[model samples]
Target: MKEKVGKQSLKFENAPYIIGAASVAGPKEIDGPMARYFDRVSEDPTFGKDSWEEGESEMVRQAVMLAIQKAGVNKDDIRYVFAGDLLGQLIASTFGIKDMEIPVFGLYGACSTCGEALSLAAMTVAAGYADNVVAEASSHYGSAEKQFRFPLEYGNQRPLSATWTVTGSGAFVVSDRESEVCIKGITTGRIVDYGVKDSLNMGACMAPAAADVIYQNLQDFDIEPTYYDRIITGDLGKVGKKILTDLLKMNQVDISDNHMDCGIEIFDNEEQDTHSGGSGCGCSATVLAGYILKKVSSGEWKRVLFVPTGALLSTVSFNEGQTIPGVAHAVVIEHHEMSKGK
Candidate 1:
């Protein structure tokens, strides 16, 4: 008789898995001939304007509600809600989930909020502490520009590396059931400061942080490039993505075509003229929630690694001449075979 290796177990007794995800946009609220200018003050003439004010919590709420509905779960069933935005104090996320009646945990990871929130949500379900959890992030051009770039009337010229703020929101629900989509693993980034001089260019500021975490993740998991189907980076934009590629190569890791950046993929970089490309909480969130999740569900890919990049800097801090610190959180999403058809 063949020797039995310990007891073979097919069942995975984890907390739960990611069942569904959804991303909602306010119909491209601000778009026009002069929308490129940061100082042009014009109301976002859109349908959801009443509830979707710039930098308001309503947008986040709408996205979360839609995610809950898509997951086929009631809001009351969610044990925990992890949400965040770039706005001060994360007011958008807090107020958005207020009516859900679930325990809400606020977070601020700049553009990386989505990944951070998702990691926490996955942990909650994986640890058996929550049956269902939600992670969400939102950002609006009008509000983000005013807070980070310039006032409506300032009319300041943007630098070549500056990124545009995306107006949208994305959310996901994790539960205790086998599903087509699942969270495989996550690597949290350590706060890194390289003493960069330029604050306006976020790519240069956050590249080091992304590199450190990505390296650490590879080291910890002992995973090779061929092991994963895709390695996606959050909002590092074109400039930062290039830097990261070179850095990874130095460590004998080669990720070329399989590597993608949410900032560059979200919009038509050439046509949209988004400077270095899109960078914001919504950039990665919307792309993953709307596009990637659907593709994963369709069985096009088996394993995916998501690294959301964040530039931990504020206008107040920048004005005070403080160096910008950066962080990135890596989350692995995969398909669970046993949970299929359940």
Candidate 2:
């Protein structure tokens, strides 16, 4: 019942079931390789909204409602909703879910907000504080570009390492109710800065944090790369995936074959001119909801180590020339096949 693991990890005694999940992506993402998996796609990024910010909020709104609907539950069934976004004040989430009337825990972990929310939601359910909880996170290319970097009008040339901010939202219904997949444990990450200052290069900034959290999770659980069928990292893109691989290999933990980056899987590198790949809260959120859990449910993977990485920086910090600090949280998800083995 203690559930406490090593310093930064927790072992849940009663793992919460991931009852349902839904993802909404923009037109660009709909054209990607994982498009078929997404529950819904917005033909236009605006979704007929007045502003891109409002459009981003609408994405979150639709995603949460779809997730709730897919779970066959009403809004009243959800005890709490943990959601977040890359917007300045998390307005994407606040304005989006305010109508749900569910008590909210608005989170901010940059791109890692999805993992943060999921971990917290699972904790709430495991602690018997809530029967049903919804964890949602979103990002919009237009909204994030306006807030974090130059507008499209600026037409600034992007560096090869630059990643596209995905316009999408994903929501998950986690509960004590029975489901095909469940969260077994969680490893909370610490903020780590390697003096990365390039705002355009998020993969470089976030990789170190992903490595740190994954290594800690492995040590805490005393497991090797072979333990999980897949070791997935969120939004690390192509460059960050290399960095994370190198860091883990240096620690004598080789996970090259089993490791998969949501950023890398979400797009086709050669065909899609996404540069390094996808990056944003939506990058991992939609991938997890749309693809990762699907694999679990289908028994394509018996167990998975899911770690969502984040670059914790703001417009003010970037403008002030502060280094970008990275953070990542690890969540252990298991299939019933592995449940019996464990």
Query: Which residue segments of model 2 deviate by more than 4 Å?
Result: 337-342
Task: Give the number of the best model, judged by TM-score.
Answer: 2
Model 2, range 23-142, lDDT digits (tens) per residue? 999988988998999999988889889988999999999999999999888889999999999999999999999888899999999999999999999999999999999999999999
Candidate 1: which stretches are off by over 4 Å?
1-15, 27-47, 50-55, 338-342
Tell me the whole-model lDDT of each prediction, alpha carbons only. 0.74, 0.91
- Give lDDT tens digits, candidate 1, residues 114-163: 88998888777877888889999878766777677777578777776777
- Give, for candidate 2, the lowest lDDT window spanning 10 residues: 333-342
Q: What's the alpha carbon RMSD for model 2?
A: 2.0
Model 2 accuracy (lDDT, Cα): 0.91
- Candidate 1 to truth, TM: 0.88
